[model samples]
Target: MRKISVQNLKGGTGKSTTVVNLGAALALKGKRVLLIDTDSQAHVGMHLGIKHSVTLFDLMTIDLSIEEAIINARENLDCIVSDKKVAVLETMLVQMPRREEILRLRARRLKNLKYDYVLVDCSPSISLMHQNALLFADYLLIPVSMDVLSLAGASSIMDSSRMLLQMYEMPLQIMGVLPTIYDGRLNMSKEVVSILETNYKKLTSVLTPIRTDVKLKEAAAAHQTIFEYDPKSRGAEDYMRLADELLELETRLDRQKQKPAEATLTA
Candidate 1:
């Protein structure tokens, strides 16, 4: 499965929103998607209008198995929920051996599960769970809102990811940096996006921007994805575009991986 973590160091950058809608979009395309909410707020389940007594907290604490914590939120989409109860894990994790690899070990069990995609929604703060998320993820999908503060936060996230790669030698690829809450009419929005595209090209792919849309907020409040809430809305349009971009990227990577094998066989 393609493992991706949708994350940002700053809250309110639409990180959770992107995770829910993007997972929905991928599932709509006929792919089996698993969303793991690492945030203590447990917003992923809430966003999808799903509630389960067992959650990721239980899985991490060995109180439940992966299959037990999985919540089928929609057709082709499953979720591992989280809540404030996850905060207690930090203390316990510290005392565990190879704590940083706990999530990674749990993730290995998923290889037999046959999911097309596994998307993790991480918390905004720096925590033990955050490190574990980075270690478990094969790719990082960063959402940068159109503001200076958010932009700075995105840079910090990138820097931290780089440090983690150097320290752990995991070589986690940065899938892309998504521009969220964009408004073309606003000068600040335009400036922030311009800076990201022009200056940060080497860091990662700059994805199509998600425009500012009230329907996005309404969708979350109503417990539906943008597509389910308002398919005709700009919010839906943006996420579909994102889904398309991600699919294309995956295809490209697959082809690249195949080329080496093909050459080895031919040679």
Candidate 2:
């Protein structure tokens, strides 16, 4: 499965929104998607209108199986929900051995599960839970709101990911930097987009920005994804495009990986 963690060090950058909508978009495209919510706020479940007694906390602290913790949130989409109880895991993880690898190790159970994508919704803070999410993911998807502080927070996430790579030698790649809540009428938004494209385009992909839409907030408030709430809305369209971009990028990367082996055989 393609494992991705949607993360940002700043709140209100649309991390949970991106995770829920993007996952829903992919699921609508006939892909089996699993969303893991690591945030204490538990926005993913709330967005999907799924309430569960068992959560990520149960999976880590107790002997809850992955299957038992997973709840079917929508057609072709399943979720491992989280709640305020997850906040205690930050302190609890400190005394655990290989705390950074806890999520990764537990996620190994998913190898036999047939999922096309596993998307993790991360909290907006630097903690053991954040490290676990980073270590467990194969790719990091950053959502940056149209603001200077959000841009800086995205940079900090990249720096921390680099540090983790050096420390653990894990092959975590940048899926893309997504600009969220973009408004073309606002000069600040335009400037932020320009800066993002100029600085990050060459380093990593600067995906098509998600346009500002009130429908997105309404969807969340209504306990549904953008696709479910307003399929024709700009928010829904943006997320659909994001799903397509991610699939194309993964396919290209797979082909690039195969080329080396193909050349080896040819030689």
Candidate 3:
């Protein structure tokens, strides 16, 4: 399974929106997807019109198992919601042994389930939740907004990820830096994308920008994905294209992995 943590230390970077829509899009393509909300705001369930009874707080802090915490949000999408109670989990974890591995240890049970992708919607701050998400995920998909503050936050997130990898010796990869809330008509937005690509492309792939569209907000308000809310909207188009791009990248990586095996077989 491809475990991804969708994070941006800056709020309003469209991180949660991307995670929700991307999961929906992948599910539409017949992939079973799971989304975990690590943010105390609990907006993931709100966006999907799901009122979760048992959230991540129960799963991690209480005796509830991960299977019991999961709620089926869509046809092929499952979710583990979070709420304000999650804020207390950070303080509680402070005294726990191997606090950073808490989420990872719980998530290992997911391997027995049939899921193609696991997307984590992390809160826009550094905390115990962020550490757990980073530790659980194999890849970090950062959504960067086209603004100076967002850029700074993205850099800080990257630095933190590097530090975590060095400290824990976990194989965590920066999957890609996605440009969100982009508007090609604005020079500032265009400049931000150019700057991100120039500065970070060597470090990680720079994905296609998510153009600013009011339809995305409309879809969220309706508690539906872009595809379900308005299939013809620009938001739907951008997310679908992103899903395809991600699949293409995975295909390339799979082929690259096979090359060494093929060479060994020939020898």
Candidate 4:
């Protein structure tokens, strides 16, 4: 399965919103998907309308098998919810041998679990769990609000990732920088876009930015994705567009990989 991580150093930048909507959109397109909420807040699960005591903690520390914790959130969409009790994983980790290596093992298991995509919603902080998520991720997408402070936080996240690469190899590449909660009427939002495009053109993607819609927050509160809540809404439409861009990027990567292999054979 291809792994994607939705991450940002600072909170409230639409990280969970991006994760749920993208996963829902992919599932709507008939792809088998697994969404993992690594945030201790368990907000992804709440958005999916799943209430459970067991969560990633069960998958990692408890006797719960992967299948046991996996919830069928929608047709072709499955989720491993985060628990408020997930803080226990950190406490539990101290007793385990090779604590940092546990996530590597889980990721290997997930690769064989018959999924087209595995989308991880990482915690806001750069903890051990976040490190493991980044290591397993094939691509990382950061959701940035159109503000100078948010952009500054994005830079810090990039720096942290580079530092983490020093401790363990990071096989993942940045997918793109996404603009979230964009408002065309707001000069602050417009200025943020300018700064990002000027500073991060290499990582910026071509997908259209998601406009700030009141319906998005409503959808989350209703325990539904934008598509499920209101397919006609701009939020749903934007996520669909983003999903298409991601699929196209994957196709390009596949072609790029094949070119080297073909050249070797021709040589």
Candidate 5:
């Protein structure tokens, strides 16, 4: 399964929104998607209208199996929800051995499952939980809004990822930098996109931006996904395109991985 963590150091950059909508879009295309919410705010559950007694905290602090913590939120989408209780883990993790690897070790069980994608919605804080998300994920998906603060958040994540790579030798790759809430009519929005493309294009892809849409906020307020709220809306269309783009990128990566083995055999 492809494990991706959607994170930004600043709040309101659409991290949870991207995770929920993108996961839903992929699920609508018949992919089995699992979303893990690591944020104390628990926006993922709110967006999906899924309430659960057992959450990520239970899975980590207790002996609860990962499978048991999972809630089937939609036809092809499942979720491991989180709540305010998850905040305590930051302090609790300090005393635990291999704290950074906790999530990764626990996630190994997912290999036995049939999920096609695992998307983690991470907290905006720099804590043990944040480190765990980075260490657990194979790829990092950053969502930057049309603002300087959001861009700074994206840069912070990139720097942190580089540090983790050098320190732990983890093979985490940048999936892409996604521009969320983009308004083409606004010069500010255009400028932000340009800056992102200019700065990050060489390191990773600057994906198709998700246009500004009131329907997205409405969908969240209604406790539904864009696809579920209004399939014909611009938000829905953008997320669908994102799903396709991500799938294509993953396919290309897989083919690239195979080329080295193919060369070895020929040699």
Candidate 6:
């Protein structure tokens, strides 16, 4: 029962794309998954072919549990949707205290659900909505494009992320920086990758670049996932590899927990 947020301070870093495909990929591995779209654009629900006008506004500001807002995308894929109207939550809940805890409260019910993962898509801008996303997250997965603005954006976001965690006293771990839409053949791309590794030494292999594949845009336009559109495509392969890395991390965490319990028994 872990919550993961995919966020970036700047736009066009493929944060939403990584979160969406990763959810689908994990489900393909038989993990029952939920994707919470905290973005105002609300493209995630559309990607799953859902036209329901009901959105996160209904769940966040009004009366609705996480389960009540969840829409079934497939046998294993579920989504808690949002829409442009979600931007109204700030004004809607401005008078209330603990407004940022909206996501945390809703997600608490998921503790008992038989879910393997909950992947959250955070809005690009820094808003209370993004705060909700962070408050509920166990870890943050930041997607940084190999571009000047996107790289610098990570530092700005680290400041904001730190502030939010400090407010809540959260001990959130950075899953890693995910580099997307990169073309290694270009000198700029290679140079940026080198700078990224040098600047962000904590980045895991999960930080490897995902090539700028045409299939990604095409699939997004069609409201389909890379796996559904072209499983053999480089973009699809990259996402699958990312998913595998996440699975390995989950396994490692489980072992880390068991080790303390084993040590206690030996003592």
- In the predicted model 2, the residue pairs found to clash are none
lDDT of 2 at 38: 97
Model 2: lDDT of residue 138: 76
lDDT of 6 at 246: 85
How large is the C-alpha RMSD of every model relative to the true structure? 4.3, 3.9, 4.3, 4.2, 3.8, 4.5
Residue 239 error for model 6, in Å?
A: 0.5
The number of residue pairs in model 1 that clash at the backbone is: 0
- How high is the CA lDDT of each candidate model? 0.86, 0.88, 0.87, 0.79, 0.89, 0.79
Off by over 4 Å in 1: 255-267
The ten-residue window of minimal lDDT in model 3 covers 258-267
* Cα lDDT for residue 145, candidate 1: 94
Question: What is the Å distance of residue 189 in model 3 from its true position?
Answer: 0.7
Positional deviation of 102 in candidate 2, in angstroms? 0.6
Residues 1-267 of candidate 4 have per-residue lDDT tens digits of 778888888888999999999999999998899998888888899988986665888777765457777888889999989887776677777788767666556656675679999889988887777876777677778889878767876787777776765467543356778889999999988888877787777443534688898889999999989987899999998999999998887876576456643311110
Error (Å) of candidate 1 at residue 52 is: 1.2
**Candidate 3 lDDT over residue span 1-267, tens digit each:** 888999889999998899999999999999999999999988889899997788998888776568998999999999999999998998899988888878898878899898999999999999989999999987889999899999998988888877876787644477788999999999999999999988887666799999999999998999998899999988999999999988887965565446633311110
- TM-score computed on alpha carbons, candidate 4: 0.90
Candidate 3 vs candidate 4: which has greater lDDT? 3
RMSD of model 4 against the true structure: 4.2
Displacement of residue 66 (Cα, Å) in model 2 is 0.8
For every model in order, what is the number of clashing pairs? 0, 0, 0, 0, 0, 0
Q: Mind giving the per-residue lDDT tens digits that candidate 6 earns over 199-261?
A: 665433346678899998888888888899899999999988888888878765565446633
* Per-residue alpha-carbon lDDT of candidate 5 for residues 47-135, written as tens digits (9 for 90 to 100): 99998999998887887678888999999999999999999988888999998888888778898998999999998877888888888
Pairs that clash in candidate 6: none
Q: Give model 5's TM-score versus the native structure.
A: 0.94
Candidate 4: the clashing residue pairs are: none
Clashing pairs in model 1, backbone N/Cα/C closer than 3 A: none
